[model samples]
Target chain A: MHSSTFNFERPIPAQPWRGVAVLVIVIILFAAAAWEVRCRAVGYGPTLNDTEDLWAQARRRVEPGSVVIVGDSRAWFDSDLDELERGLGSRPVQLAQPGSCAYPVLEDLANDENFHGTIICSIVPRMFFAPGGPLVENARKAVKRYHTQTLAQRASHRLAVPLEEHVAFLKERDLTTEALLKELPIPNRPGALVPPRPPPYFQSVDRERRARMTESCANPGRLQTRVKTGWSRLFTPPPPPRYIPKEAFEQRIAQAIEARFRDTTAAVEKLRRRGGKVVFVRFPVSGELKAFEDQSTPRTGIWDRLIRDSAAPGIYFEDFPELASFTCPEWSHLSAGDSVEFTRRLVPHLRTALGM
Target chain B: MLGFFKYGNFLLENFQWVLARGGITYKPPHLDVFLPIGISFYTFHSLSYTLDIYRGVMGPTRSLRDFALAVSFFPQLVAGPIVRAGDFLPQLEAPPKPQNDRFLWGLVLMTLGLFEKVVLADTMLAGSADSVFGYAGPLIALDSWLGVIAFAGQIFFDFAGYSTCAIGAALCLGFHLKDNFRFPYAAIGFSDFWRRRHISLSTFLRDYLYIPLGGNRSGAARAMINLIIVMFIGGLWHGAAWTFVVWGLLHGSYLVIERLLKAFVRPTTWTESLGVKLLIGLATYAAVCLAWVFFRASDFTVATRLLRGMFGGHAQADAILSTREILQIGIVTLGMFIVQWSLRETSLEAAVARLPRSVVTAAWAFMAGALILTQGNSNAFIYFQF
Candidate 1:
């Protein structure tokens, strides 16, 4: 069929390379110019996107004595980057992503030869203890991508980093196709038109939370926190048990955590051998969320065991009343002002551990 | 390092199972690894090039530039029509003289490829197929069949879409890539289906592997063994898993059954009656879909569960897919069947080229708009695995 169909007698062009080159140049030029115009329209410059490439670029810029903060969204929001930098001497490099677990980033740093300074890891009890759990797959994915990425990714990341730093339009938090589809008004079928509910507006925390959304997906603004607190006040009653104990499920969960801890311990000890020590910080979680965390994985069972096994010194916030009483607006994270205080309060503990 | 990382995920998982059987548990950190983007296609391309040279069907290319250019030819590099020496190398001898019309036609073909991938495959079919194959809960027969059918459509469009892009892109560069697909959904039988679908790779196997195994020149039992062996190798080439092996064996069984039946089944059943032809076509599609369950599933258990679900051997009729999703899948799949059937006698480009310019323009615009609206995560072509 192939031999029958091919037009073998067709004359070759004099210089197909010229045509290919021209097309390539035109498409690239057009895309670059169009992106600039679009970014400008959005009141942003065409900045490099902050994909793994950009994140890896940031990771590559690490130097000895530069504090690398790695953990989840609590690490992302609860620690004021500026405050941490002021309290410590150097400007901190932020590696933590919102809604991500800590161990992946810790694992990454442990593997890296260049990064010899302290990694102030914010420990979310459930995520650190349950490596294979559903909630923290993002961190796992990020780590996997980093391990498997190509050197060509570095060039692409280098190209995109400027755009990311300048243009808000290129942020990871921007509306994705899946997100837009979820919010779409389209009904699942005909006849029964699913009338879309109006936006919750001032009545809910969503709009306010959304307004505070930055590239990092960290909502740390005063207005956002106030709105969240107001919303939280309306529902002061704690959520019912987030996880029910099933024997097989719990066994797998524990095994998953223990296995990761063992792997992480070897890696961390290697880092220690390389003249760097890893310090864990239990970020403040308040009210119902803290209660849920306490019930789900208490200090003795999960966190303490992890610290002991990994041989990493951990600062549980409840041990220090100065850091502990700062109210978390969402029961998960400290607010904008509270974060600054929290950062100021927490840096000394980290510095002491780092032998600063 | 790349090889280790690429196959590491699969190897580590399998090894963990091996280790577990020995009463030892292992969870290597490297187990959490990403696959090399297009190792399967690359391996096949290399295999085709080497085997043809070994068979003396083609001479070894002493020219490194020509060899590199053919293998790494950008258009078909990642996902391919699975080219051999005769497929692409000779075209690189002289400077290309790509005509503008051919170039424009190439652009149009790229648009068509994008439409098939984005609008039909990813947007419409992927969700439903994923729902069915990935469904942990019980599923009834109807949804299960729809899911499998959607998958058949999905893989076809995804791979065909990529192949079309490769062909068109090569044409633009004044190189000819032979057509990979030829209205495969409209094939008359198993042999006909293989001839139509992924034509290059199938033909490559026929010429190199099948012929080397004595083809049909040998007696019946030996020929059957040869066919099964070729098919088994072909299946394993797609992946490293047992499911792929099963998928290959199933198709091999189908071809064997077809050859055996061809001896006894009269010509009138296939040639003269449209009802019989349609019935046969449907039965072929059903069998193909059954095989695809193994092709698509993670393991034999998942494949068996889905097959059982398709036969109404499930405890629950859970509604995972929405009615709207079902409708969208149905329309796209029907559209594909109708189009492929109509174009069985003629090529897609040839058919389109006959239409009025305005009609073509309108069609392109409609497809482009639909694609823009429904564009998903630009998933790599499905055949990139093999």
Candidate 2:
């Protein structure tokens, strides 16, 4: 509608360096400095995220006599693979996928000819009580999506792992210019921001390192108050008591147990037939999370049924005093410090259960 | 493109269900999303190029590389403003023009577009719309309206956001693409709405489809029939679904009724009044939104249920969304409309150019902040699936 914004009289830079040379460099420097400050303030060092690549790296290092660990995030993150390996005099291969259903991985390991070593799977009640098929569909979806991506996509992801490990700025995908624009409090609309989606990491990271990064990231801004933490706060004034109908509760619980039993047992039998031992480990969960798991899937109700029907040796953490004594900072996954200790404490019990 | 393959399969699936096995009844073994993401759009882009060349409106290109570049221009290659060859091809030969003003303007635009996409469309609107649309059971009145209204905003932002990004990216490279959208929500009539929304596609359909079908020059009856026919095919062009056809029919009916009403209902003086314009604009938007129900729903049953809820069929159903979620839709949708209406007669860059330096910087800062606050794994633009 008006004059051209471009000033054609001015000579342009040559190809491949036409624009934003200085600007891009300046922005990068400024951002790097900002992130350096934030990381230093939060006391987090250069640490790679716990990702699929790291998991693969760990898996590749598994020796023939090594015990293969498989389950979900709880099993993988709550124990130090190195510590467990040292404690048991055997290495550990972590095939434990976060958000994965345990049975499928179990089934895969059972069918493997090369892996005749012991298996340890931690069963969180939610996955065990869920009526769906093994939630290992993520592995399939990831594979499909992976195939569709270009070499550039792969390279970019590979580049991001190191960048994320080093720079807090790269770690914050939501802190982009585009994302920050929408955070302005202009209204006639909702001011609420959608929670950021985690970047898909193809490589494995140090579990301890990632947990620490998460801790750093969750730090509040100046205006934001710190979240209250206490044993009493876990119960609160307590959440409003919810009522589930007896018929619905029992029906769901029955269906869930049946599915878990049918799937887990099949996996265990196949593993046993291959001269490999299968053992279930209940990971340390405490506070409100433990309460909910206990109620939704009582040890007697679901865990006992699976162990009984599968004929696999089980270790309920509650049954052993030391295993249950470890503090779970998040009440789901153990902190980096405690995970090593927890692994050390459980090694003898795990050895006994595997009849090693 | 695999889009045609998917469309053919979709038609066959729906055909058997609606027509009671009138032909071969085939369903794939498993649910697979095999359809190419932006096949429909690229097809139209190429289609427009070919038509222009065939009609002697644009010269045939001798350079295959330039032609390919035009067709596969990455900015709008997938979901597009459907840039025409006459506008974009010549610019390809020109060397890159680097000016701080143009570059900064492009960055500003890109930021705005991304904000519209991930924040407003995906985060705020999509969740609410999905809750109602994907529900197996019935939705109540408030829920249905909220769902559809949110959709009206979502579809607008999603596609417009894409076009804005394309335009901005091209702008940064010193290639100008005509703006694809205007203040579509503020349009005072069906025809006005068409003029504003997806300007390239609408014009192409008008020139290639409507005019060839004898347009308004043919008598009233033939013209009306032509309009309906063009729109019906236009709907089918989006996808092979019957729902799309119904959406077209709804729009066609609105246009016809508006045509009939134009002669008698309006006092010429009243038409100039801002209040009257606002009233008409709102009514037109509501009409467009109702048509969107058919466009968005999976099938006739869902559409029927949605319509029933809209007209007060179900008032007592349990709420599917929280207040915060609804608040999100309202705020984002309102913010979009306010911005659009405010800058109705000017471009975003132009409007910002007129602003004081401090205000412009602050606005850019706010945009950046907003984008960070509302991140999501946004699905591809809604139009890309077409």
Candidate 3:
């Protein structure tokens, strides 16, 4: 019936809508079941994606004098929080992110005047000295989330955790339609400037942001090869933009790198002045990837300069045979088993470095 | 308040530039303003009420609570269909009656909207568009055109998706918000495009701004001037940027030209033919896409560069998009065009009504499944900026 008054009522289509709804629900349930099965068969397991919200959740747990792990993926994957808690007599908050620069997190902690805490910073020269772009942006994004996370985001993360713990198909980074789309084997035109794709899901993350190398990825197989190759693509510096002159671009990069050095020193000094301790640890790197890193961003250039400039104690893995004896399966990160052993061997050094 | 938040810094920067040009140094303290989400939308929502009351179209409501609800309805609060206070207030007078059909349909619409936004806009198109637009150097023609096409599709889905969600959510609560989009890509003329896209804003401008300025009551020349003036304001309504102003002005010019052409070239059999209509429809879309360059670009420099590339000005430039990205853009754009054109002549409800029950169930299921596959990774709605 039409209303003559201003109150308009839209026409409902004459169909069995309730029946349709039931059918839709049934179909969705079936589809979800199939998808979960397929996802499991393809080797995806129920694990947390290291999202900004998850990082923020972990960041909120930081107390005034807590031990915190901060840096790139090496810190994220290699630092066993349980072992560190046992050795250092306090658990460390894992604030490190994969493919992220440590500078932003370090700067954030230094600025948090109340936090005169211990920082065990991982130093991969290529990642640590990154002045800007995705490496720095990633850390900055997590810090920003920590500062600006809304109630809804926090609630959503809480709800998502339970679902993520049981669902193999809920891999946000790899199983999402966008990520899957990128996996398509389509060639680019000659001279096309496409960015390299990130490595696939090869690590499992916990609620506390601790990452471990998946058994499949840790083994010498296709997954290992894929992860290894992906690293080389990721670590190699992209060519300068065509719009900018090569000399100018190089000069700008050099200036940015120099700024990073000064900033890192200032941050370290600031933290130390506030009675906080910092230990820069160079985790293991091996094989061709180690050779590549050694050639591209040698320890002598950035690492030695950082230790000298900041006057902070550093633990170089290569300096100790106990640490250097462990080989990274993918030439970058330790296997899940080795990471435990690695952490066990390294905790005494961490204790010594922090004067514990 | 909306003006101060959205345009304060823009005004200050422009004033500084003007002062510099006049050989006088003037420095204004930058106002660090955070724009309240949906300020523009709510401003318009409240403004419509005041104007409606002022013009005696409707008497002011006695209930302050109802008026407040009308102004700040949660479904359309942040990004909107720009629901007019008059349309919304009457529905709140009575308590809503729950209907299972209405609720289910609303869920269907919400699912479809999310699919458009997350799966299509974010996953398929955003990356290529971002790569193309964010590229510092010039791009080849294919990449340039594909980028623009991707953006055209992305914006349509992003905005229309929000509007659809808003409308569907409102329906779920027994409120009837009018449609914001109606197959705008299939529009045959600039005026038609305006009619079909962001229908509320267009109607608002027509009633409040255009008619207030005497609309077409004056001579043709005066009417043309009025059109430009209305469009200039419309452009400025989008943002404080001159690029947005130019985008508005380009549409203004297109409307003026369409008017001029209609006056001189009487419709003949050839012009009225289906083929000619299709051709004109395509031309209208292309022109609209061209205008979108200014709308989407950060500045005139980007708009000009893209335009140059679009017209074969960058033959020796780099090709940035991959084959997969190219195919994604092409396929999505084509599919959008087909769906829009097909549905141009009828309402979505009518089209859905004609479909069999099984088909409807499957389509709904597919959209829902696809949405789940997206893992809720979507950017904020595009219109939330405006």
DockQ of predictions, in order shown: 0.09, 0.13, 0.53
lDDT of 3 by residue, B1-386 (tens): 88789899989999999999999899999887778878998899999989988887777888888878888898889888887777777787678899999998888888888888888888889888888787778877888889999999999999898888888888898888888999999998999999999899999999999889889998899888888988998999889999999999999999999999999999999998989989999999999999999998988888889889998897457788988898999899999989999999999898899899989988999999989889954688888889
Give the lDDT of residue B128 in candidate 1: 82
Looking at model 3 chain A, report the run of 10 residues with the lowest lDDT sum.
Answer: A1-10
Instruction: For residues B177-259, write the lDDT of model 1, one tens digit per residue.
Output: 88889989888789989989988878878887898889989998788888899899788767778899899999999999999
Question: How would you class the docking of model 3?
Answer: medium
TM-scores, in order shown?
Answer: 0.74, 0.79, 0.97
Model 3: how far is A54 from its true place, Å? 0.5
Q: Give the lDDT of residue A234 in candidate 1.
A: 30
* Docking quality level of the chain pair in candidate 2: incorrect
Error of 1 at B255 (Å): 1.5
- Sorting all predicted structures by lDDT, with the top scorer first, yields 3, 1, 2
lDDT of model 3, residue B162: 86
lDDT winner between 1 and 2, please give it: 1
Per-residue C-alpha lDDT of model 1 across residues A254-302, encoded as one tens digit per residue: 6887787787788789888888878888888877767767876688987
Better of 2 and 3 by DockQ: 3
In CAPRI terms, where does candidate 1 land? incorrect
lDDT (10s digit) by residue, model 2, range B253-331: 8888888788678668878898998898889989998999999999999999888888888644434655666777788
